[model samples]
Target: MAGLQRELTLRFLAEPADVNFGGKVHGGAVMKWIDLAGYACAAAWSGKYCITAYAGGIRFVQPIHVGNIVEVSAKVIYTGRSSMHLGVDVKAGDPKESTRSLTTHCVLVMVAVDSNGKPTEIPEWVPTSEIDIEMRDSAIRLMDMRKKIGAEMEAHIHP
Candidate 1:
């Protein structure tokens, strides 16, 4: 199956209510938007309900101010038997401005689920474009790093 639909972009205006005491948009708010965009992309690709299994490397590069126009983009970069890995990027800038700066980025792992909440396999996605291939390869490399990190973390925990 063609997987070109496994990408999504969402845009919203950051209002006063979205800002913290510092007058910058809250990190949690941006994270919520990221999750929503990732979920939408995964669901569209899998054609099934999905749940976020993990979110890694969340980096807030810049603060998003109130009244800034926010854009969240999510794309499927890799997939397992039942899980889809997504790369999400968030950007914000003045609505009238021609340029937007990246505010945050993260990778999310989402697993397709059935009505019983059990993980289910979805169609495999093969990268057709040069950019898609590059992204998929990057995701594979990151997944290897994630595994090593998880192993180290587990070794230190004695629970």
Candidate 2:
């Protein structure tokens, strides 16, 4: 809507407990942050509770070390009747540094839900900037790819 927020940012420090055997932040930890950020953005945009329907194109571009400041940013790029597509980016850097590099990126689809947990209608998201338009188009393209993949998987399973 006119005054609604479409984006969210979460910042936290990577802790020792979040590290994996490789001495870097675990992939699962980053994924959880992505989901949390996406959900917050989706719920804010829809003004309702939301649940994650899909998450895809997860890319780990760099490693996050313990004590690094991690920032997860999420924005709504597109919307269906009950679903919102979120583009999420995770960045990490040393606490004493001034720059953070992108560590992970993903797109997630979250569906607004009612009190009974059924899908509920959500306000449409309109792209107002060039970047917003491009991101929305990208989300649409990914959705199309997912449909084709799902169809192929279904065919193989049935055959």
Candidate 3:
């Protein structure tokens, strides 16, 4: 696996439409944001269009309540021939109350595919800074989590 500093970070103001009956942002909505950020990070890192091949280890660590501003950050961690590992984290804050917490975190695996939907080689990952090391470690851990979850999912399907 290689490394790249490509990332996408976005801030969104939580609204009623983003939350559920429990008054927290819907898990699916969080996942949608993760997917978008992950894919965009991968595409930017590889300089090619990318599609998500898998999502795993999606954990809701805290609840993002309505009226909070949520910040999402994502980046590419690992790259194979045509595949990448992405990490996404969601944090919630209030402009007035000064509260910030990690609401969710997820691991995304994406593949670079050509116009014909065939997998294509990714660009070379060049890491020249300390931040790259942290990203590499994060990617490794995220990949391990993905593998474990994938195994469990497979067992559920096959068993």
Candidate 4:
């Protein structure tokens, strides 16, 4: 299905309300945007309602100022029977300037669900280009790392 339309981008102007006391956009606002973009990508790819199962590795690289042109891009880099893993990037730049710097990045896992809210099978995404392959591989590496971390956490919590 031609990579299954695996990417989605959302762009808008950062509002004054998005800023914190320090006058920069709050981290929580950016996270909300990431979730929104991730949900859109997952739903488009799966053709079903999706819910986030995991969101981690959120890194805030820089602060975003209000009135900046903000862009959040979400791409489905890997998929399983019911889960789509997305890499989301957030960037912002002065409206008068052409350059945009990355402000945040994270990986999210979203699961497609049926009317009963149970996980359901969805279409798979296949990498088609070199960049796509690289992105997919990166997502797989992150997945492996997450599993290791989860095991460690379980051990620490129970033992």
**Per-model TM against the reference:** 0.93, 0.96, 0.80, 0.94
Give the alpha carbon lDDT tens digit for every residue of 56-139 in model 1. 999999999999999999999999999999999999999999799999999999999999999999888888899999999999
Number of backbone collisions per candidate: 0, 0, 0, 0
Per-residue lDDT over 1-159 for candidate 2, one digit per residue giving the tens place of the 0 to 100 score: 521999989999999999999999999999999999998899889989999999999999999999999999999999999999999999999989989999999999999999999999999888999999999999999999999999999988999
Which numbered prediction scores highest in lDDT against the true structure? 2
Query: Which stretches of candidate 4 lie above 4 Å from their native place?
Result: 1-3
| TM accuracy, model 3 | 0.80
On the 0 to 100 scale, the lDDT of residue 14 in model 4 is: 98
Q: For model 2, how big is the CA root-mean-square deviation? A: 1.4
TM-score of candidate 2 on Cα atoms, chains taken together: 0.96
Best by TM-score: 2
- Which lDDT values do the candidates have, in the order given? 0.92, 0.94, 0.81, 0.93
| Preferred candidate (lDDT higher): 1 or 3 | 1
Candidate 4: C-alpha lDDT = 0.93
1-159: candidate 4 lDDT, tens digit per residue: 323678889999999999998999999999999999999999989999999999999999999999999999999999999999999999999989999999999999999999999999998788889998998999899989999999999988999
Residue 86, candidate 3: C-alpha displacement in angstroms? 1.0
User: lDDT ranking from best to worst?
Assistant: 2, 4, 1, 3
